[model samples]
Target chain A: MTETRLTEKTAGIRDVAARAGVSQTTVSHVLNATPHTRVSEETAARVRVAAEELGYRPNRLARGLRTQASEMIGLLTEEIATTPHAGRIILGAQEEASRHNLTLAIINSELNPDPEVPPVQVQAFLDRQVDGIIYATVYHDEIVAPENLSARPAVLIGARDSSGILPAVLPDERAGAVAVVEMLVARGHRRIAFAASAEDVPATRGRLGGYLEAMAAAGLPTEGLVAEGSSDARGGYTATNALLDAGPTALFCYNDRMAMGAYRAAGECGLSIPGDLSVVGFDDQAPIPESLFPPLTTVALPHYEMGAWAVDALYAVVSGSGERATSFAPTLLPCPLVERESVAAPRA
Target chain B: MTETRLTEKTAGIRDVAARAGVSQTTVSHVLNATPHTRVSEETAARVRVAAEELGYRPNRLARGLRTQASEMIGLLTEEIATTPHAGRIILGAQEEASRHNLTLAIINSELNPDPEVPPVQVQAFLDRQVDGIIYATVYHDEIVAPENLSARPAVLIGARDSSGILPAVLPDERAGAVAVVEMLVARGHRRIAFAASAEDVPATRGRLGGYLEAMAAAGLPTEGLVAEGSSDARGGYTATNALLDAGPTALFCYNDRMAMGAYRAAGECGLSIPGDLSVVGFDDQAPIPESLFPPLTTVALPHYEMGAWAVDALYAVVSGSGERATSFAPTLLPCPLVERESVAAPRA
Candidate 1:
């Protein structure tokens, strides 16, 4: 395709008016796609042609009032910096937003909200006049709408309750955990330990429940194998050490960060991954899995894909097409085990 | 602070003018902060008060033309999906831009730039009217500037050689490399290996130079240990295996991705980190130290700080306060060794 010489600096509506032998106001009305115009269709088309030839791009924001649409969505992510899964979510949301030619105005609150603290900084989105809002929760919790947020259409990501007040998209945490356990059992691993975080968050409970359900269904012992740790590596290290003391051959981690901590503790305890203690991790968004000591045997959750699905759900709501909760599903992507150096036959 | 009751409606310049008892032209001049206006100080204060009270936000792009400033910076990231470090850069730039009340327009090319692409499509930023541009390259290469980009003030990040044309802010690759090697050597490591991508690139060359310099200073042999690898975990793994074959007690990787590869190789070969082989990596931005089995002992480059600095440099140029390159010491931020489980005393 021959490159069009559309210079950054272009003549305004006055230039178009002069070329078309019409008033500047007439040219602007045609350019703005104004309603209730007395001008004939043929005349409007001529003005549009002249403006296009001049490469006069209309300012969408300025014309938003006329169109009642800015074609922009505001994404408010809580604790983007700290959340390990947020990167993929943002990436997915951006891709979907761009695909639709809609701009995403993203704002992240790194601070995790205390119960007493205000839930969100909704004012930013309000000020921007965003067409819709996607509120991605840092941790799954009871849906608490900050007072007076009902004016705009909004969607929630990772909400514990979907009362259908607004549409919500979340990962099927229970199914993900069950899949991880089933994979290890299928691999002939009898002794399986569940390493969970100390935080009593909804997502953690769901994951823990899944682990127990899987063990019960498989007719295996769940006692003495479940250990609690912090959300970070140090927590994983301590939990792994305790789990090892009880002599579990296979360890299932709640998340990638905890898995890393388990890796460190195993190293210190002289237990080789797969060879000694086969490790399986959830939320395979971490960059270290490919390079982990025994490239980790992880059950990868499609975090980015989930985010993309959320975007699609939000788009449906904003476009007035897809039904509220009907369009949104708690997407349960099957967690697949990434077979690497992490799993091997149990040491004799 | 009492939450301000937001009145949900579009408040325009005309509303502010009527409330202030001033002309629309006077309100525009006052909002633009335009000089050469003989409006009384009291009148100007009244206009400002009216604008604030009525919530009259100026249309940025149109006013940008009148003032010849957008108060916005355009950030061109090399890739947003793969390189996690680029996200940090975006965050830093966005934070700095927001602090200065400047909006940030980000465009990410996943590094697949085809020369055949038209200038208008490639330069999606042209319509945005950004006052300054920060071109953040994930890898070092000659950027094919958009036709007539020289007219716009820009700063390149992650690569120097602005080709004596535009300003640049780059991480001191040589210094970063030297620092990692020095840390490994201080821990009584002698046979240290340097693993990097194909050494033709500027970053690879600079890092290689530092490795050689450090080896010479330490009076250690540089033969057979320096190996070329890809810039990802697989490359790091292959290069590390080669380095191990060459019998290096310690390893210095080009970046975290490469270091991750080394970590995997070391695990596969039954080598415990720090005990069997000490490993150090670069660019501690993402899930490197925390995600690695033993939190990696690697260099943490200021990717976000560089982004902030790049914006500051561009601001200086746009504001016409400082020279093209505010300074050229390359901001020698010593990538301090984060002593995790990765590095240990070389086995005697």
Candidate 2:
């Protein structure tokens, strides 16, 4: 009711503990929801009453130190400013961060110019004093380390060949690619072509390699298969048109964009998806599989798990209870072919 | 080279300053390129020599507070989980962040869901102690204050009505839509249709409103215009297909994904871009515009400036040099019609 009430100074947690004649530890236990700790009901009620009256705010920094825990984690995204799927990764990371009572501070390593720890950035983290670091690359490659992160625990998301040095979480990329190719083959398409951009990026390479491996592993002809496609829908469209010239019955795309391109090109060529030419995509991103007149059946990366595992690893370090570098076996969460109106038996 | 050597504790700036018999201030001045502060040639040389010998790593946080003046800005993204253009916003923010010698720490508000200030996330910033906060919302709205942030300086990015308390940097939605419409109109398209998501989102509403304004302003018929698209590519595609049935010769999509949908539907309808139907899009999102067979002609948001400006505005408050709640007129950076194979004159 009073104007001064709006600007009154709030009391600290220490004040409440002092007023209730309880230790700061007890107040923290009550606030943090630490179960199994017993306190008399009357005493708890008294403490709550005092805290409510005083409007005491907790100093998380000091509390975190006492608990030997920091409810904060670092999320380092690779190719953040460039990749389309980066949004999904951040979303998954946020979901995981919420579930674990951890907050994330994101850094775009893409702009660092240097692959290793840019000195300036390292100091920035030091100033903020993050509990753990999660280095995420767009797709995955062997992520190189920056200088001086030994004191702080860290985790890697995406493709980093960890020889058991630090914890890493990567997608079942090879399996995803294989699933797409196998689906195309099941549709009775013999001459399947691959469309992808930049053969150098790990995910691109992995998908392409998986296609080849799946084809060869299945004894399908490797001749005249695979086209170097760009990482966008337009590139996919162009590449599909080019591959069609070679008389391929079906196509496996690197990512969703290229698959969208193939959808357009196929439509332009008057070829029915899965009826004349079956199309499969990797990295089931937005709109492509769902927005396409026929929903796309593409490989879905375990983005959510990658974020969750990375945080778990970080927390393990904070608790000093987990393996230093835990390597999670890539779990393929089925990129099973979603049969829509898209695929029909390929016309001979 | 011994592997153990890499683990040696690196010398800090203070160590170098002590060794050089110089004040930390002089060392900072030498490193930061400040002109007004004077140091003798001999003293400068000695300080440099000492710094080099000790392999001094400057404390970026401390140095930033002094001579460097925190080029680092905080880009506080709202709910990184569900936003469409947040990654692009981050990209623009990063580009601007680096251009200004400022680094960005993107924090997700979703991690903490406090009505006043979510319980989990605020501590992440407090520990890091970022110089300024840039509150970036995917859609514009009033900002709910995070607890204990009254002392912190911050700017609102992408909020239209900021309640006259926070400096806001948002996309000039109307101008952007106008630019897209103008490009289509200039290319000789008359029957233009608009595809947008829900009107609840400020961005979508502004862009859709801009499209209508541009249409009426250009004396074009607003009949049969569609604004029932979602913010995804599939939504764009479906909306575009429906609009095509209305016999529109050109389409101005809400975002790139919608344009992408148009591309697919166009293919399905055996229509050639620019030849049969022309399309324009907003947001030059990656893999969408570039991956398109003929790269998309779309309006791009000044994502980085949004971030950089937010930081600058926040700094104005932190430095106690500016008024609270400054407003940045949403800028329209001339969405230069990226003359691609998308749009052309209506078929003769």
Candidate 3:
């Protein structure tokens, strides 16, 4: 055996073949366990022993370069690492990728301020020749497609292009808001106050639309019931105080953080949850909803499912098996309600 | 341009060189904007125009294969994507890597159950020839080095190997705990109660040790002042109730989450914060500390800085510029206290 092959750096296939006293093809067949390779059992055993001795690992990249394929996917995320609760997208994608025997390479684009798809990371993915790419956003929004993203089959998670040309997976904010109101109304509450998220956010529009639709369906008055605030705990606090002055028996917050703020606001007003006022929240972010005094009842963002579906869609596109569209509409997944202690029947 | 070069896939450097009537090396020098390259202005302009016309991007992998270096780092994280607040590690690492023109490829090994380093991810990184690997944990703990990890320079983040062989970057939990207690003592509060974290976690031992040391230094009684909890809001709530019954004027919680619980408990007992009871917390986690009614006075985890330092250490080892030890000692960074509305002088 060559002294160089025994070094700490991984031994190559040529080294294994040399140590085993066999051709490189024979070693490859033996290591891959390729069917019908006609390699004898004794030779296979020798190859295995030689590989173990030399610490030989199959060069997956070299193999990929030869075959023009690597069972790997690239995930490009915007602000996921810096933002709260969005890392679940990466987790979901990783889980699904593993099930398909594909590894995921994640690149966070938060460091690059350029709105364009980060060229460096995209170039890296291209150099590696990933089978597909999934572009994810920290929050639901519209995105301008990067100029240099045409190399691989790509899909969007939690976002969509303005031209509607990209396949996108998103949470059904409208449905989630409808569910929250339906649950609250069923608990014998009529005077419902909506603490709306900021106007510019796409989720705010969808959630408000759902609230308006639900209120109209129930023939409940909507006048002077909507309180505007940013999508944060402080916003929820300020909005709740204003809504309380108008006398809402129940409050529906834009998100769980805002709901927590409402909890503190209720305490200051000398009101107890479920006794004098009931509360409902959206985006059942962990530790926050679960740690609340009453354990907030909220809608779960379909982040995990969206991530999984994005992978599936990207795989289909890469495999050329799914229907191809010039301009695909956004695929909306359900945001189910997580029942907890926050919501209760309105007081008599 | 050839028909293949005009396809959606990125055009190669050869295509640009052929069209620009220049050598591949010249094209590379022009595209990379290398400072010392002697390419003429006319030649550089021609290379740029050809690259733009053909949409050519240099293949980083092919270049890496030639140079035996990819200028890429692999980050193997356990549960960073699934856990809260830990993603900052990735963000910090990413920022530092970018500054050095090194891209980070992240793979979450938590999907794999084996305690050893995840073989698949390591193989992928090997295939791509990553310069180094950083194995990070979601929380501080001891880990078993994965087999076949000797090929690349590696370091641990937020964890240490049982053999003490791998260089580790960790939060100074003892120092953080000591700082918290010292700050409280300086405020003239001698009757302090500790709402401790779960006993099994490594942070718990360090924090408890620091608390005991600080109390002893202050000549205060430590017995009957430590109330154990599981490091959650509910645990804080339960432990705080027990501690308050002992007539303590202040409470130090294991974490921000637990401090929140303490707030609820104190509220239920009709005690106002700082007015009747002062509270301090560890791990100044976002939104939780900031959203609390009076805000929270807590110790910062130094997650971002630890991540940056780990990358620096790994780079040093990879470049052969720093002292390399078989069993390196743990590197502990400072955990400074963040003063906010939660801490105050004890009631007269």
Candidate 4:
């Protein structure tokens, strides 16, 4: 229990300007992050340092009443308890929010609880006067957000708004799968096998579709080259066993988990990775890819990118300097290939 | 990118009380979460529903100005980017905060940078006027917190504060380790080996200490049984291989990653888990324990419990209903053993 508050006198704009040896207008632009402002990095850093030293916190509530902006952004994420990568998204959003002197407050929503009504969590953000809302959903390809979300600048991540009114961003899972196949083909592997997941999630379809399309484009026969698994390490092991029976020289797993199984399967068969058999995976899940013996070469999802993009876009809207979404198409951010020791040329 | 404000008119506490057929005092006690008050769960539920129906939100700023409480808690975490379970901590704190009608804001601190000065992130939270702060660190056995942290009701997770004034909660890694050894000994395993970590962290010491203590109690010879590894899969494999030379019938890894390597070493040596040589791990890392075949039996770090405890403790202090920490010792929370399929009776 705190006995007495030790915080010093709250500093005002004039105090910050005087401390930084800058004009009040300059302090305003730096702290408020006004658009189209030209302040050198050095001067901006000085102003921020001065503000921190003087404990000058811009009265966000009062300022919101004056400028119709709260300088607070709300991120509504779904299933953070299960999704390991959700932290990455939060980190990106929080750091980017800090860069703009905006506070990023978060609330994790239960997994797609209701389809008929908007979540009450959105109203809580509005209660706190958040300037914008970013809803990150994974259960749906298209989501209908709370009608009141439009009352403030809002963006969607991992799903498009079915109303086609809100801007959205998603990872290109299909493209990432395709890239993995292409890389394997370039590595002089003709019979590249796929360990497909049996689950019916969006990613399963996207990844399988890419694998099939890439194989067809490479003029490779799919006959006996695809095996379905349950999307875990065991599934990978079983499916890789079947695919190995087909005499494939390379394996492209549905995800890093399956690739883990593939590694086990390969070790059982006494085949060294990147030498006797090349392997690749998607969804470069943390610790998994790096913890593997030879390490795994997998495709990384654009979670951090999506989080940063939402803030930058929302900040623009709040500053009245950027366009709102008018198109229904969701922007698919690239899933970059992370090469490690997993993929290599097939032996003669 | 919002076109217009569509949020409905705000509802006050009077309106909620009228809707719920309760007095304003009841509504205040329920919504403000005032301690030392008698309110039935049914009545609280009715009040909450009425508040939600009318889209009512108490003006936190106005109320805070009068009550000297911000209704906001700041959580500053270390190495959220790498600590896989940091999200668990955030989730627990957040859910608990919501239950108390408080907003939880988070700022992730980079790992152990500039050990002398207080992290600026704390000041950012202070600037916004958080009623309390929760600092979560894993790098230290005991740390000197920012001197000003005493200005508010503060709690620490994963480490003890040097000042001994701030209440802190830590996982009982040693107990968890001791439990595993005792469990194995109960299963008639006398030659159990430990795949120890080479990392110089608090966990490494705690876990090893528990194992050595437990083995001594069990009247088992640990000579030539403990082998050091790099704290990853490769390290586990090397350590297990060396330990196996002593003909141990069971293995305990420092963490999950090392257990992964132990699995590989077992597989290569033609040993079946829980059939020939049982294995256990610590940390219960996401995806790893479950992904491993035979599923690892391991210890959980009580991350969620710590997060929830910090919030509950802080709320008590804020409400002037709980004891402030005057002890130099940290509270050790139980690290529960999550028994999956990896452990079994050692082969006779």
Per-residue lDDT over B13-121 for candidate 1, one digit per residue giving the tens place of the 0 to 100 score: 8999999999999998888777787788899999999999986766544455556565667776666677676667777777777666666655556664653454442
Let me know the DockQ for model 1.
0.28
Error of 2 at B228 (Å): 5.4
lDDT tens readout by residue for model 3, A146-232: 755656778888788766777888889998888888888898889999998875778888888888899888888878889988787
DockQ of 2: 0.31
Candidate 2, A1-348: lDDT as tens digits: 223323654477788999988987787777666799987778788788888888665644455545434465667676776665667666666666666666666666654455565545444454445678777776546655565444467767775644446666677677778876777777677787888675577777677778889999888886767677667776787788778888887777887778887887887778877777777777767545666667776777767667777777778766567655544453233344445556666786
Better of 1 and 2 by TM-score: 1
How do all models score by TM-score? Answer: 0.80, 0.79, 0.88, 0.89
Winner of 1 and 2 under DockQ: 2
lDDT of candidate 2 at residue B290, scale 0 to 100: 68
Tens-digit lDDT string for candidate 4 (A72-94): 89988898888889998999888
For residues B103-201, what per-residue lDDT tens digits would candidate 4 score against the true structure?
A: 888888788656577678887777667889999987687888887676678999998877687899999999999999999999899999999999999
Better DockQ candidate (2, 3): 3
Q: Among these predicted structures, which one has the highest lDDT?
A: 4
Which 10-residue span in candidate 4 chain B carries the lowest summed lDDT?
Answer: B1-10
**Model 3's DockQ score:** 0.46
What interface-residue Cα RMSD does candidate 3 give after superposition?
A: 2.2
Query: Residue B8 lDDT in model 1?
Result: 58
- Candidate 3: list runs displaced more than 4 Å: A1-6, A15-56, A111-121, A245-247, B1-6, B19-56, B111-120
Tens digit of lDDT per residue, candidate 3, span B185-250?
999999999999875778888888889899999898877788988788999998998899777888
| CA shift of A267, model 2, Å | 2.4
